[model samples]
Target: MGNEDFKQDKLIPIAQRSFASYEEMYRIVDFLNKTLKEKYNIMFGLTKNNKDGSMVITIYEF
Candidate 1:
């Protein structure tokens, strides 16, 4: 099978805060996951968390 070429748009920083709690993080992550899946058909997994407790989202490309 031939390979499919894909191009990604520039990444814009997106931040969401709710009551300064970790529960807000889950909502943001879930939103990001669904958006990426619907828009790019890609699945991302959590790679790491910073010392300050912020998370890093990883988009895996096939």
Candidate 2:
């Protein structure tokens, strides 16, 4: 692969919320939000139950 591909891979395309319970999910969400803001200066749009009862988190680079 090329350097660009490697970099892209580092930016996760899909992330599923942890198997932890509701409370844990909130903690994870908050942690992820803060971490992204601090490290990449990015904000993610978190989606819970996009379909059925699944949770998805997506972070787009600005």
Instruction: Give the top-scoring candidate (lDDT).
Output: 2
- lDDT against true structure, model 2: 0.56
lDDT of 2 by residue, 1-62 (tens): 98645555555444334332253565766787778755774545566664556556666553
Compared with the true structure, model 2 gives a TM-score of 0.45
Candidate 2, which segments miss by more than 4 Å at Cα? 1-23
Query: Model 1, 45: alpha-carbon shift in Å?
Result: 2.0
Q: Model 1 Cα RMSD, Å? A: 6.7
For TM-score, the strongest prediction is: 2
- Per-residue lDDT of candidate 1, residues 6-54 (tens digit): 4234333343232323545557667877787657665554533445655
